[model samples]
Target: MPFVIILVVLTVPAAIFFCWYQMLVRKYKNSSFIMVYHKVDRYRGGLKGLCVSPEAFDRQMDYLYRRGYRAIPLGSLVDSIINKKDILPKTFVLTFDDGYENNYVNVLPVLKKYGWTATVFLNAGAIGQTVQYPMQPPEKHLTAEQIKEMSGRFDFEPHGITHRALTGLSDDEIREEAEGSKKVVEQLTGKDADIFCYPFGEYNGRVINLLKEAGYRASCTTLPGIVRQDADAYQLPRFEFKETKVWSPRYFFRNFDFYLRTFFAI
Candidate 1:
């Protein structure tokens, strides 16, 4: 009985560990990780998880740089997948949601420091608007001028005009939101607004069709996972980089391990 009990304890943990290791391997191998960030600020209010401090952002970028991860634009990733090219090792795409002024102020410098660029999804109605979400005060979001200034380092895309959930709107309304925002972004940036990010990550078949009609080549969702070659272009998943545990090396690894284990079940 004693021998049997010891064997069971050892075997159980060993089996679990082996399974977890396999999951990690599967999760990272031949996959491109897309990380989504919202506000890069020192603000303590609102959804704290959505706000990553500039210092933390710098450290995270430094970590990626030290680890030899290559930051690629989302458009390049889409083209590669469409062309059936193998995703390079340690390739990652950085995305920022919400056209917050802080993103230009805090996030841009860090990215520029590393000579990297990211995709920013802009809420068409919020741009140049004084107020921001969670009832923040004016000048919260990026202005048209600010966006143009940062065009060299950021690829701006539409995040819906009013940031409404596309799934809840009627077909015509969805088309207006999707197509209108795309046009607005293109007008402001003088570049094709080829990508869309579903506001609140809420989408459906009709919404997807609307985005396609609007000339969007791809869209991003809040769904958590590494982007595989076979993944849907409109429903691409992203890893939300929360500020809570991302700063701690131990906690970050622990959370990452948990994410891999949870998403890639054996």
Candidate 2:
């Protein structure tokens, strides 16, 4: 009788978990993922370092490629969503924020192999500079030559004039960050710089208005959600790929609940 009771207790929970896993799979079946990445460099400070190893990135890209996933630029995805155009199946976007030097050295090679283009959001004021973080090694931003070289493959976009919290700035300062960045990045890419990513994913109404005035059509936020045609253009959500976790199938299955909550924002 005790054995029968133990079997019932274990099997019931296992069956319930299986059902929930199947449901999450069905819910986000058609959803598009806009993956956010920072430095594609050596790891430090663990996952909080916001760094994904190049080897892990290679594996993730290979997995996606094998699954028939196609990569697209952020602006193109936003335009289609805003204009109510049909979105292709199994499409994803790759965005690198903070314009790290490692992105050029590490990420670009993997992208070239896949014939993919990504968006790089640069802090216009911090060009050719190294940014220091507390208790971690200093990270370098992309240099002008690197930007120019990758401009054809990377859609260089404005992050800000300085990597400051836009919500804390005055209206004029916000405008400067927005308009000033647009001007410089357009010069670098020789194309329309219409997309903006908020510094540290921080923004307010003033920042949005200034971005619109600066001719920006869309912006990215660090919010967690899947992209749909009805998603807000100015407040797009993304999931950052960091080395804190290896993005293997076992990791995902084991942490499916955590991902489901963060990804779907439930």
Report, for every candidate in turn, its global Cα lDDT versus the true structure: 0.83, 0.81
Q: Model 1 TM-score?
A: 0.83
Candidate 2 local lDDT, 1-266, one digit each (tens): 99999999999999998998778766655456688888787776534548778998898788777767778988778878889886666788999988889999999999999999899999888778898745557788899999999877888899888788999999888888899999998887788999999988998887888888879899999875678777879988886655665477754664453356344432
lDDT of 1: 0.83
Scored by TM-score, the top model is 1
What is the per-residue lDDT of model 1 for residues 1-266, given as tens digits with 9 covering 90 to 100? 99999999999999999987887777666668788998888965766778788998898788777767768889988887777777777778999998899998998888889899899999998888766565544447899899999988899999999888989999999989988999999999988998999999999888898888879889999987777777788888888888776658765663573345334431
Tell how far residue 253 is off in model 2, in angstroms. 11
In model 1, the Cα lDDT at residue 12 comes to: 99
Query: For candidate 2, what is the lDDT?
Result: 0.81
